[model samples]
Target: MVKGVILRQFHSLILLLFMLDTFANSTDIQPLRQLRPRLVHLYNWAQRTPDYNVIWDLCCDHGLLGLHLHQATTAYGTHVHLVDQVEPIVDKLQTQYAHRQDGNLSICLTPAEHIRLAKQAKQLFIIAGVGGETVASIIQSILPAIQALPPSPHQQIDMLISPNKHVFSLRRALQAMPFTLIEEEFVSDKGRHHEHMFLRYQPAAPTPPSEVGDALWLPATQDKRIYIDKLIKHYGALSQYSPTAFNQQALAAYQALKHKLFGE
Candidate 1:
């Protein structure tokens, strides 16, 4: 009886604390409010710098990206745009943020059109889903728009992309462009595996082709290291033309990074 009473007391206390926190926080009116913690981490990291003004969420399903931003108290003033194709998806978006106008949310029905818009100093382009190739093309389109815009107050990344496949190809092309990585993440959300990265580039920090390489090694972070280790261990055994997540190039990228496994 005593243990049951104590457990009830603890639950009540936790509920009280949650209520207090909710009261302390102001709700940003968001239509499709779903919080993805990993993505929230991405936004919080980008917001650390004053110059990244725009946050673009492409291939956004149900506007969950906007939902996550709304939960963050510090992410206001950053123009958050959601992009996805299909009438049903946009229809759902309309149902969600119908009255929002204070720069908290904007809807883009055409992904390519928005990609071609001029990049701003505060712009932060995010393209997820699809393959690395599509992500690269969006970045390519955004570059022209970036050129048309007046010089931003500061030089930072123009895009952050998370492709479903062909990440190796994506990274290789990014190395060739004026993009610098801000953060990379490996997340398993609701049984789905995802690798997301945040990148920004300034024209001033032009990448020299001489320093460019054909392959990119995973950074020495614990998660990336573990990811590489897993891949390298599985590489040789993976059969060709297999319907699996890691492709031949991914296996190759893992092979290239095997040196990192031994602290080489």
Candidate 2:
């Protein structure tokens, strides 16, 4: 009885300390209402996707998006897995979710490439808030597993990726792969342009992914226009710096895109 009482008191003390810390740093901590626009857009897009049995939020920092997904998808009996390589982050997440009885949520301390993909279950893997190179590397590591899955009428594995940089190279690398683009969007948040893409895996893909993205130029939104300008400038600088055939080609591609869009 005495040991039980002491354990209860320790738990109460830990809770009180957590509450105090939260209260002290409340200004620095962004509430759910203040989630970044890019994340909000990603979540909204994920919500539009078709039925899925599981979601893997890879490189999930702070677990905001995954937690939000869990809350929303729990009703549909979806399992949400948040994976991060950081031990501290995984520990904190485990603590936060220890009380849940639903057994549908999992927190894994592993690299995105290390997690096993569910072959039979419809799954959506969300890789966001990381550079395109990292995202590409993770995809490369997991491509073999994705390819081994049995084909189904509903795609066995779908992906939603939002990478902050090197999107062109990432797309170029994916062009020869089995991933087919289903949706694309450009979001400007905190003075950075993010490319969000939804893709499905097929053993025999019908359409090759565009290296520079086909539909990004169609809408001509202010953000898209600005991002196009940045892309042109970026490629121009790269071409000057290296003058490689590939760099020149990339530079010319963006310049041509600009002319096509603005009639320059």
Candidate 3:
């Protein structure tokens, strides 16, 4: 009886080890429990648009979002590049994920603006977890290099950006560029409001004010109202402090937006 019990225990231990190994090797890992909603929103958006040959996650801190994208689209030949300027973070990510069997991942220790792309590749650049001003600056810095590429019908590049603040300024900057807004969303996460947008460069097309996206006011939710109020206060302060024609115009626009959204 003793021998039989030991034998059964040994079998159970082996089974437990097998289950652990399977779990560790599984590709369908659940998202990190603490992932912010803005990142989650971006990941879902990437999954929805899976035709890109390469996905670049700029300023990718821990490479969580890029890794998630790799798992979701690797079977379809999508490669994920995680770019960050920090050396330690990049090295850590490289050590962790660079040895995967499928080999569709790259970790780049460089600024977002320095990363270049092949002219014939369909690329999606995800810029998140930063301020709007920084996001705009990165876009501006990279625009010249991207424009110099030889035009190809297959060379499609898209940017998905979620800026933490100064969204209106960012919107204006984007409008001034050759890019057109494809989609925009206002996401409230962890008591913070985030504005996310997908933009594609279309040099021949003009971007209208509608493309700048007033969608933040459409939902009529408390969060939306709060966001509007914040915008109003922000522009109000800007107009009061600077009192420039530009500031006044922006204030007028925000006031108009408030009136349209809340009838106040």
C-alpha local distance difference test of each model? 0.61, 0.80, 0.81
Against the correct fold, how does model 3 do in TM-score?
0.83
Lowest summed-lDDT stretch of 10 residues in model 2?
A: 26-35
lDDT per residue as tens, model 3, 82-170: 99898999888877765542567888889866777767888899999888888989889888878888989899888899988877678
List the candidate 2 regions with Cα displacement exceeding 4 Å: 1-34, 100-102, 152-155
Order of candidate numbers by lDDT, starting with the best: 3, 2, 1
Tens-digit lDDT track of model 2 for 92-191: 9887666542688888999766778775788889999888878889888888778777776655788899998888788887787788788887788888
Candidate numbers sorted by TM-score from highest down: 3, 2, 1
TM-score of each: 0.65, 0.82, 0.83
- Using TM-score as the measure, the top candidate is 3
Winner of 1 and 3 under lDDT = 3
Residue by residue across 136-200, what tens digits does model 1's lDDT show? 77777667666666765554555555576656667767767776655566665554445676666
